[model samples]
Target: MKKVVVTGVGIVSPLGIGKQANWDGVTSGRSGIGPISLFEPDEGLITKFAGEIPEFDATHWLSKPEARRYDRFLHVALAAGLEAVEDSGLVIDDSNAQRVATILGVGLGGMPFLEETIGQRIATRKLRRVSPFFIPGLIANMAPGLLSIYTGARGESWTATSACASANHAIGASLRALRSGACDVALTGGAEAVVCHTTIAGFNAMKALSTRNDDPATASRPFDSGRDGFVLGEGAAVLVLETEEHAQARGATVYAEVAGFGATADAHHITAPRPDGDGAVQAMSMALQDGGLAREQVGYINAHGTSTPANDKMETAAIRTLFGDHAERLAVSSTKSMTGHLLGAAAAVEAVFSVMALQQGILPPTINQFASDPECDLDYIPHQARKAEVEVALSNSLGFGGTNAAVAFRSAR
Candidate 1:
């Protein structure tokens, strides 16, 4: 298999609009959660708190006419993809455009726009009133399609959806494609912008959102005893993945190696994780084996700690099962404590965080961990950042449908 490496990364997250800003905020232990401003919600909708990316001006990133046709998800993906391509320094000319593919992961694509269109149709009873771009804007695959069109990429382009694990799966799949000589380069990541009234109400009704409306910043307390549930967040994250030989030939800076990827299904439940964390453990072990590394080699972990009661404890248990004694010494932290849950986009951003940790030798913190829980007993690196020499890092992402993925990254020496 061809060696794969990440040459560039771009992010449009709740913390900030670009890679630098988002990383700075995450390392500094800043919280992006705030009062909802996207739309008005009723009292029962639980719209008071969310990790919203504030003041995102699509027109600034895209042309006015293009911005109007695409949905917010596509706009964010295109903006981030452009940034990643520019950062990678690989020119996508006509000669090699056909060898460049785009794979994006999205959970709820154009959900708000679809809801608005349905509402208008019901109110006006005129199906023709909908814009011609409605269908293109609402499809999940449109994010990658728009990217391919904008970049003149004529290779395979599609969207992968596995709930929150969507981005990890997409990135892993893209790496496989490059390794197999199917594509020379790939743009892979995930984007989401589903923070709307109906979505919020649905999560609220399911009791799956934090109710800390009065204190938005402290709402997403991962591994904390007082935690209730996850706070919804929105954004996009993209990475430039290429074979090591290709990147070296082009003199591109290699961030880290895409060492291994493991995916598993619980086959147990739809919304909740397995009680014994069997799927998570299997995924982690498989990733380690595939990376050709032992358990002790992993220096840090970017946990999928969604600030939920079940997920935090279950993930901790899974880690302990796989790492054994090394679990206690390994530095584990959940960036979600600061960024909240981006759903489909969560894993891609967290994977970026893992690679950054391996590169910079710093572990991001799981902020808002006021009181530790006995169930989640590990070095969470709570409430503050830690400087450590990290050579290998693991990022875990679990989704709603019992789908779990674990990715391992090694520093480029």
Candidate 2:
């Protein structure tokens, strides 16, 4: 198999608009959660808080005409993809552009747009009232499709949806394609912008959202006894993955090696994780085997700690089962506590955090963990960042469909 390395990364999250800004916020233990400002929630909505990307100017990333055609989700994806491509510093001309692919994950694709169109149709009662670009803007695959079109990348382009694990699946699939000689370079990541009435109502009805509207920052407290549920967030994160030979040939600065990827289905429940965390353990074990790494070599873990009771405890159990003696020595943190839950984009953003940890030797903190629970008895790096020499890092992402994925990364020495 070909050696895969991350040459560049991009992020558009609630903390900030760019990669460095987001990293600084995560490392500094800042919280981005606040009351929802996109739409009023007084109209019978249970949850009224979200982690919205503040001060975002769509015109900065998209042309006025282009912005009209695409939805907000596509705009985020395109902006992040462009940032990743620019960071890679790879001069992809017409001759080499065909070798670059785009694979992005999106969970709720254009839900806001769908709702808007439906409302318009009901009010006007005209079939021709819908915008011509509505269908293209609402498709899940259009996230990557827009990237390919903008960058002139003619290689394989598609979107993967595995609930919250969508981005990890997309990144792992891109690495496999590159290793199989299908593509030399790829842009992979995830995006989600579904903080609207319909989605919020559904999540609220299911009791899956945090209702701490008074104190938004303290709402997402992962591993804490007072934890309630996750705060809905919207953002996108993208990465540039290239073959080691390809990156070296271009003298690109490699961040870290995409050592391994493991995926499994719980086959047990639709929303809840397996009671014993069997799927998570299996996924972590497979990732270690795939990376040819020992359990002790993993210095840090970016956990899927979704600030929920079941997920936090189950993920902790899974780690203890997989790592055994090494579990206590690992530095684990949940960036979600700071960035809120970006749903499909969670794994992609955390993957960027893992790579950055290995490169900068700084572990981001799992903020908002005031009172630790006995079940989640691990080094969560609570409330503050830590400086550690990390050689290898693992990121875990679990989704609602009982889908789990673990990705391993090694420092580019």
Tell me each candidate's TM-score.
Answer: 0.98, 0.98
Q: In candidate 2, what are the lDDT values of residues 1-413, reduced to their tens digit?
A: 78999999999999999998998999999999998998777669988899999987778988898887888889899889899999999767798888999999898899888777666687778766678888998899999999998888888999999999999999999989889989999999899988898889999988989899889999999999999998999999999999999999999999999999999999999999998999999988888888899899999999999998899999999999999998989999999998999888899999999999999989999989778799999999989999999888999999989999999999986
Candidate 1 stretches with Cα past 4 Å from truth are none
Model 2 CA lDDT for position 230:
89
Model 2 clashing-pair count = 0
All predictions: root-mean-square deviation over Cα?
1.2, 1.1
What's the lDDT for residue 394 in model 2? 92
In candidate 2 the C-alpha lDDT for residue 397 amounts to 92
